[model samples]
Target: MILTGSRLEVMHFVGEKVEGYMKEFLKPVETYWQPADLLPDPTQENFLEEVKLLRESARELSYDYMAVLIGDTITEEALPTYESWLMEVEGVNQADYDQGWSKWVRAWTAEENRHGDLLNKFLYLSGRVNMRAMEQSTQYLISDGFDIGTGRDPYRNFVYTSFQELATNISHRRTATLAKQAGCPQLSKICGVIASDEMRHAKAYSAFIREVFAVDPSEMMLAFEDMMRKKIVMPAHFLRETGTKIGETFSHFSDAAQRLGVYTTIDYIEIMESLLNEWQIETVTDLNDAGQRARDYLVALPARLRRIADRTRIPTLEYPFSWIA
Candidate 1:
């Protein structure tokens, strides 16, 4: 993306494997479970009664849990921004319109499209969220877009997606666990499925990075280091509520997530650690001096991050979210 000649070549090389990766990572649309399968059907005879029961189960959920769920849903519902951004990446779309990279992005977006659909419908049935307010927030997030600092660089974008997918998997898995504990088995199952999808996607993206590291170790290492230096910003960093300024709602939403232990600083450090191990970063060799220093910074990063994480405190204050009223 930065006028690097090899970047486009590498993207083409990876694009060649799209068919295999698709088969391995993506489920067929016909066989895949749609949101309707997990949710009550409106056309069913007992649909009203089923929704009543679903609402009853949702009532048992904690306030923080509900808030975090709404935030996650909004983040997922802003899929259009992510898809558009990815499609514009340096080499992803420079090839044929029907190329593997384009197909992968579309298919991935299609699958991800269900996540927000399912969650939004469930929340609507739950009767806990202010749908109008929540919908407005989602619209704001998409309209506002975000600055994750990748700037169309495929290497940097892959790194961001790899970390993000794992983070979402963790949060969704935890939410699923809490949902089961809160006696909402249906929602728990829904989150479990979504978490599974995230895991598969994470594996796909991470594998792509692993391959890049093998061929372009120096550049790959530099990109990874650059991202860590930039501190991979979450996709929902621009999250805000109705009447709120840009990014004003993220702090409150993050606080709710931290308070609920759904997604926190500790979890963030763990994900970073896991990625380092997943990529075998410590073992990588053949780098230039700058790349070596970048590797060193990444090597000591987990401990440094842990110490910082230890000193930080999640705010004890609770804020009322407009989306929850």
Candidate 2:
């Protein structure tokens, strides 16, 4: 199929395989795990006892860990923003359900919805969170939204999602390990399951990019390069507390994450390296001059980023977050 560098053409070509992607990457709703499965059930006779035990385990978690978890939960809670953004991509038409991109968006959103649900409920029951403040932050994040530099292009959007999902997987996996070390086995399990979902989602987006590269190598390569040059910003980059300025809270939240080694600069560079490897950017052929230049820049970015990361330092000071009690 000769694509005329039309993003719509590429997206349409790839959208045809959405069903197969869903089958391979997403779990059926009925069989998939729900937040209720991991949380204390209200109707059970032992509900109060379970709640007590949950709180006791939560007490073992560190302040920084709690802050990072709360930030992650808020990011997940802004699902509406993400869904709406993807729906607006060039080839995705929410009204045209027959065109598979919209279906993929809805299905992907459905799977992602559980992440926030599970984390929010756990934080509320944990007795360590200021629920009202956390709720306020979530509201703010959704309202503020974010501009991740994709600008309605499917290729750039897929690249952003691919990177974001991998980053989320890393942070959640690290949190799971930390939770277990803190003796909070239940929380560890929650983070672990969420991390598993993220990894699957990452692979799905990465696959989409790989498919695009096969058919429209030059344009896809250029898109990948543009996003990397702009830097893939997180969905929660605009996160702010109730009275704080836009993005003020996120800096503190990020510092807490760095202090805990949940997600760091090194992880960002490694994700880039992994994507270059996964997409086999080095050996991609049939690229025009600009595309080849883009490929070269992307290929060399990881080593350059590593040098900057080595010189950078994370602040040791802890900032008090409004979300924590």
Candidate 3:
């Protein structure tokens, strides 16, 4: 649905929705994720050495795949765009409030950069650039940048991160499977590690949003409805230089491959269901009339997603992203 109304009108309702969700959920579940173990060994020198090795390994594989995936340029074209977007949408625009958010983005970027680096190196070391196809893909992807609205809505940001993180995990896992199939155990191992990290990243957003749902179930439910209606995009969408192709990719998947991959709509709904159940969103007390309506609406999300999947009749391939369609 189009957000056709005045900005003020939109913000008013959205803000109330946010407030309600936060008061009822976010505030109540304010405890953050904090692990007690410092590192694998907890010895500073050994930890540092291990981290350095992991970083070096990741960098190598990242560049190797980047070269294979985007031609042998290694120009860091997409990095700048991502950095700019990160700066533009620093959650809620408060310097103070964004410290953690900023740090998270930075760390994620740093890690992601290594993926490109390692991929490029591997391609360079092993000669794998399909120049014409890779360059064309990159050009198309970069021509259209990912669009994050100017509203600086934190919850929207939250939603974006949650899905994107999961998408990345899915991508990495699939890449690993492909690598293993191609007889490269090393690449598969590296991607497997990266996929683990991506899973954690997804959990962070999922858990945080669960807290938001707790803070104000009514507002969160409404916000979720609004977000689902709008649909979310990946951060790399605008930077990959193949926006059209990427969209085509999604469309193709929707039409013929959704049931094939772990990223299918059914998978997505299941993740949401797991999260809501873990947070006990349905058990929250004293929901207002609006909240009740929102709850009823959410109750249909799984069925709706399943119906869409069934209607599409996309073949269910055993491996993620392995569908021919």
Q: Top lDDT: which candidate number? A: 2
| Model 1 alpha-carbon drift over 4 Å, by segment | 1-5
Reference-based lDDT, each prediction: 0.92, 0.94, 0.50
Write the residue-wise lDDT of candidate 1 on 1-325 in tens digits: 2224489888887788888999999999999999999999899999999999999999999888988999999999999999999998988883567899999999999999999999999999899999999999999999999889899899999999999999999999999999999999999999999999999999999999987887778889999999998998889999998888999899888998898888999888889899999999989977888889999999899899999988998888887898885
Provide the global lDDT of candidate 2 against the true structure: 0.94
- For candidate 3, give the lDDT of residue 29: 19
Q: How close to the true structure is residue 3 of candidate 3, measured as C-alpha lDDT?
A: 38
Query: How well does candidate 3 score on lDDT at residue 300?
Result: 70
lDDT at 107, model 3: 49
Q: Per-residue lDDT of 1-325 in model 2, one digit per residue for the tens? A: 5477688878878888989999999999999899999999999999999999999999999999999999999999999999999999999999997777888899999999999999999999999999999999999899988999999989899999999999999999999999999999999999999999999999999999989988999999999999999998889999998889999999999999999999999999999999999999999998999999999999999999999999999999999898899
TM-score against truth, every candidate: 0.97, 0.99, 0.61
**Poorest stretch of ten by lDDT in candidate 2:** 1-10
lDDT of 3 by residue, 87-174 (tens): 5552422254434445445545554555545544444333334444444544555555557442355556666667666766776686
Ranking by lDDT: 2, 1, 3
Higher TM-score: candidate 1 or 2?
Answer: 2
Candidate 2: Cα lDDT at 62: 98
